[model samples]
Target: MFERGTPGADRIDALRGWVGDGGGLLMVGGYLSFTGFEGKAAYRNTALHEVLPVELLPEDDRVELPAGGRASAVGTGHPALGGVTGEWPPLLGYNRVRPRPGAEVLATLGGDPLVAVAGYGAGRSAVFTSDCSPHWAPAAFCEQWDGYARVFGGLVEWLSQ
Candidate 1:
């Protein structure tokens, strides 16, 4: 799992190598993520995107779901979602993603994919279109959702396998 503030290419290669070598990756989205707003990340061409199950299209709009905004439905029965009980907290923001062929949809918002999974070599990858911040993923960061820890833990566990 990686976070915002990770330096560019160095990190990209590290992550790319990890996935290519059969290690799991959990890429949580943010302003520093895939083609982030205003093309801030365009230079590095995020390595995770190459193997991501969905294609992250550049958009001018910035999504910001206010704290305590609304809860989106989880993909019932999903290994990462299972045992995650209660309403989800508003995710402050996310990068919009376009699902690619063979991608598995684990969750969505307004028909937009919120979470996706993909396989790369002997490893695999999981993506959360939103940041792992209280201001970004309000529910998950604030622990308002009972399944917060479980979901994250489950994702790591599953991806590792």
Candidate 2:
């Protein structure tokens, strides 16, 4: 996952190669992800951007929702959303991203891509446009949300396939 800090060119190239050769990649969002705080993540110009399913905006894209935002599965049947049903706990915030052509939006929050997946050569990649824990996810989402395991586990399962 390419989060807060930018990886060196060599590392970025290697990661691109690995994904092209069937390695799975998952990018998680946070204050330090995709154009992070003040655009610190800086992945838009990196090789990692090539494999992502979303286009990173140039500026800081964090959106804070103190009252929380609703997250819902997009389609009727996406494996990544297996077992994940009903109203999800409100999220504190997420990074804004635009889905790329051929990418599948598995979930959304306020019409924004919350979870998305795409194929990268022989491998698969996914993006979770929100934190998996804390501030964004909130304690309820981490500890009490019944679909947590299904949501995350299904993502790994889909990527591995």
Count of backbone clashes, every candidate in sequence: 1, 0
lDDT of 1 at 129: 75
lDDT of 1: 0.70
lDDT of each: 0.70, 0.88
Residues 1-161, model 2: lDDT tens digits: 45567654588889999999998898998998888999998898799999999999999989888899989887538887766778888889999999999999989987889999999999999999989988799988878888877888988998888
What TM-score, computed on C-alpha atoms, does each candidate reach? 0.78, 0.92
Superposed Cα deviation of residue 120, candidate 1 (Å): 1.0
Residue-level error in angstroms, candidate 2, position 29: 0.7
Q: lDDT by residue for model 1 over 59-161, one digit each (tens)?
A: 5324666643443645666676545655666666777778888878787754667778878877888887777666577645556666677778778887978
Error of 2 at 32 (Å): 0.9
Error in Å for residue 90 of model 1: 2.0
